[model samples]
Each structure stands twice: as structure tokens, then as C-alpha cells.
Target: PCPQHRERALARQARLTKPPGSLGRLEGVAVELAALQASDRPDLDAVAITVFAADHGVCAEGVSAFPQAVTGQMIANFVTGGAAISVLARHLDARLEVVNLGTVAPPPVSDGVVDETIAPGTDNLAVRPAMSPEQLDAALAAGDRAAARAAEAGARLFVGGEMGIGNTTSASAVACALLGKPARSLTGPGTGLDRYGVGRKVAVIERALRRHADPRDPLQALASVGGFEIAALAGAFIGAAARGLVVLVDGFIVTVAALAAVRLRPELRPWLVFSHQSAEPGHVRLLQTLEAEPLLCLDLRLGEGSGAALAVPLLRQACALHNEMATFEDAGVQDRS
Candidate 1:
């Protein structure tokens, strides 16, 4: 993020044929985009979206509504180009990938899906760490590989998404530990969990947080309670920012990973563009924790980078307006005294 570029973008925006700041936060987005690209003109021409699919051992706690089989099934759907993200990527003409971080069933391998299983799934976090030190490192490395592939292909913007049953429980526990809050404060329904399931999920998160004793170290907290996909998502965010690519963070589980990444590297915060606000209750607090104002708030809770993909077109519009709109002088408009 170059200060000179940001200043130039602001100056250019003020001279456009519109009231100063009339475009609201969108105008700020354009300026930030310019700063990140280190150019007065910035565009999101190349976009890549990665979906990390894994399963959580905490489903044994009866926390999620859907069965664990759904994780692998959804991965297969992604590979077959049948999932929501698949359609969105094709519609937007963005490169989409599905990374097999870990799943109980085989991931139905395909070109767009990578094979990097750390394990069949994580260990039951209720009784043990979700991933061992070695497995955690492997998952993070797998995520790095995904990000590198995207950047190497000339992707200017990156999206990190997640797919895992019972992952909300893992994300909630991680948030509670990172923020020193209770599960009751952060837990929400995941995968259409009913009220009873939500209650059980909260209880499971509380126990895990207690067992970990509210770990202050982000890695310890992540390894203590985070799911494999969650860890991978965090790694992808760090990798994207290191590669100087913008990251559009997705819904609840993915945002939790983004929070972990920011905790690991505070400088990475500027590279993130929160895609949307999730319908999940705890998302608002998480957004506040990051001080992020998302691009949309349509109550979307579907993960798998769906929200981020939808916001890509809006970013294109912002850039187009910033670059193509006529200046006040060109439009023959009078400036207010």
C-alpha cells in the first residue's frame, strides 16, 4: 500500500464529476485499490477463488445438522461444477479451485481440485487437538500452494473460502479463545442446525475453550480448536497478502480464519476486503473485531466463497467508475464555492 498512490487516487476522485465523497465507502474502496496496486488506476481484472474442503471430528459431538458425508459430497459437487461456487465462478469467468485439505471420503479428484489431504479429517477437538503440530503445518502449507497457484496464474484478487461440517463449532471456539469470550456469545447455527443443535454446538465450543483455557497464542488457539479447513483458509489469506494480492474474505468460518491471519500478521489487514456480512449471529462481533465494513449485508450464510464471488462484480464496477467517469472540467460542471 503506497501512500503517494492513495493520495493521487483521492485527488483524482475529488476532481471527478460528482460531489466529493458522494460515492461513500465505494470511493474509499477505489482509493485503497489504487494504493494496493501502487497505481492511480487499479482494476480487478483477474480473480481467483479457492475453496478448501475438509471435515471436522467435532461432528461426533452431535453439533451439526448435516452428516459428515456432506463435506465430501460437496467437494464432488465442486469438482463436477454443480455447486453454487462452481456456477458463480463460471458466470463471473473467474478461476475457481477446490482444495482437498482433508475429508473422510475421497475428494473426487479433478483438474480444478487439488489433492493435498493432511488427514482423513481432524481429531475430535473435544477430546484432543483438531490437528497435531505436523498436520497443522501440512494443512497450512497446502493452503500456501493453493494461493501460489492462483497468483502465479496472474490473479490480482484472491478469495479464500471453506467447506466443512461442524466447522462453525471450530470457528466459534477459535473466536472465543482469541477474543476471550464464551461460546454462548459466539456460537451460531451451521449447516442448518436447529435450535437444539445450536445449543449443543455452543456447549461443545464452551468445553473446548475451557479445555484449552482460552489460549492467547493464535497458533495454539487454532491448533487447539480450529478445523483443518479453517487453518488452511488462514494460511491462504497470509499467502495471498504476501504475494501482494487482494483477499476478499467470505462468511463466518472463513472470516474466523481471516481473523487468525490478521492476528498472525497485523500488516495483512490492509490487504483484506470483507466480502459480505454473514447471517450467523457472531459475524457482526467478528467484523467489529477486525473493524471491517463488508461490501454487502444480504444475510448470506452460505460459505464456499459464495459471498466473495458475488462481490467481485461490484469491485469491477467501482474500478470502472473510478477510471472511466468524466472529470468536472470535461463535463463542464461548476464546482461549488
Candidate 2:
């Protein structure tokens, strides 16, 4: 973040008609965006939402209530303007795209989806590493390419989304490995799983954790337990930070990706603005670990970047208040003395 711009923003805020810190977190959001964009007036006029879809081998363990085919179907839904993110993107007029990282079967039609398949899916993480080092590199590169696309499109904000069955399991295992937490503490019902299913999911993650014990770094942890889309999201977050784009992180799965990216590159923390606290139980722990205060907590578990997209308007409003509000002198009002 640019300290000079931040100072300028703070001074501008103090001069606004309202009292100091009257606007609450909105004031802070504006200043942070100013610092991130290195502009006295930061705006999120151009937002890009990229949803990376893939299947997870961990689905074989019955971790998700939905079938693995749903991942590919959802990829089609995203491109065809039938998914939640698609509608949200339309509502926000944001540039939306989906990347097919890897699924069991290719979507029936992918007219607009970016193809970045690493494999059919990751290996079953419960018994072995989720992905090979080379596959992980490929996923990260795919994310970098997405960032390049967003930058090319003149996007000021980047929102990364993921669509993968059993991804919560992957994310939970990754978080457990990174945070050194137990699976039972980090795991939660995914895809509307019942209590029994949640228990099974926890046990599956525990096995994966034991199998890939003591990951030395974020990349290792990601490769050990992260899904293709999860890795891609991490890569995209890192890439967005490199390009100086403010990243709006989504729910639990996306937060896990952000966690890995932040662990891999500590400086990326400032570039990330978390969107919400998810219904998933592990999200709070991830947020706490990252020291992120999200914009909302609507019990949203949808993973199509919908949560982040929902927060865009709030950030835009912050920028608007910062850039357009009248100062005390401009309004011919007495100064606070």
C-alpha cells in the first residue's frame, strides 16, 4: 500500500462535512482503497470476477452431498448466465468469466470459459497428495493468466471464485495443515451435508492430514490437500496483488486460498479485502488467523464469488463518499475546533 496516498486520504476524510470517523468502516475502506490504488480518489469502476471450476478427487470419499458432475454443470451454468455469480455479475456490470481448471467431464458447452485443466482432478488427498508439484505450478500459472486478463481489461478490483465438489474438504484439510488445527475444528457441513456426513468429512480430512503431515510451506500444503480451483484462486490472489489490484476475497474456500497465498507471500495481505464470514465453521478460524474483518456475515456459503460481488457496491459507495462528499469549508460550515 502507498503510505503517501493513505495520508492524503486521511487528511481528506478529516476535512469532510461529517465529524471524524463518523462514517465508521466506510472511512477506513476508502483510505485503504486509496492506498491500494495510489490515488487520492480510488474507485471500483471496473471489477472482474473469475470463477475457477474443477472436480476434487476427495469426492470419492463422499465428502460432498452433490455429485462431482455438478462442478462441470456449474461451469456451464456460469458461462451461460444461469449461475448466481452470473446474475450478480450482470447486476454489478462486472466482467465475469469462468475457468475450467479440471473436472471429471468437460462441460457440454464452454463457449466463454477459460480452459486451464490440470488433470481430470486432483488425486484423492485422503490417501495421498492431492496434486503433483507440476500440477500445482500449472494451476498457479493459470491464475496468473487470469490476473493478466483482468489487468488487460482495466479492472480495479479482482474477485476470485471457486466451484468444485468436495472443495470444502480440500480447503479444510489445507487450513488444518497450514494452521496446525484439527480437522474436526476446521471441518463443517458442505453442500448441505448432515451431521453424519460432516463426521465422515472430518475423518477423511484427518486421514489426509496424517498422510501429508508437516507441510514445510504454503505451496506444499496446497499441493497436498488443495483442489485445482483452490490453487488457482490462491495463484490469482497473488497475481492480483502483484498487479496492484484490490482483491475481494470470498467465503471459506476462497479464504483458504487467500490464506495459502498470504503465507506464500506475506506482502499480499494488504491487497486483500475479505468479503464475508461464511456459514462454514472453518471460515472464522481462517479470518482470525489472517486478522481480516469482512464486510458482511449473511451466512452465505455459495462459492461463485457472489459474496465478494455483493460487497463491491459497498466499496464503491465508500469511494464515492470519499471523492464526492463536501468538506467543511466547501459547505461553509465551521471547523471542528
- What is candidate 2's lDDT per residue for 108-142, written digit by digit as tens? 88899899988988999999899999999999999
Best by lDDT: 2
lDDT by residue (33-97, candidate 1, tens digit) is: 99998877798988999999998899899988788888988998997888999999998889988
lDDT of 2 at 243: 92
- Model 1, clash count? 0
lDDT against the true structure, per candidate, is 0.88, 0.92
Deviation from native of the Cα of residue 165 in model 1, angstroms: 1.2
Q: Which ten residues in a row have the lowest lDDT in candidate 1?
A: 104-113
Candidate 1 lDDT (Cα, 0 to 1):
0.88
Q: Look at candidate 2 and tell me the lDDT of residue 63.
A: 88
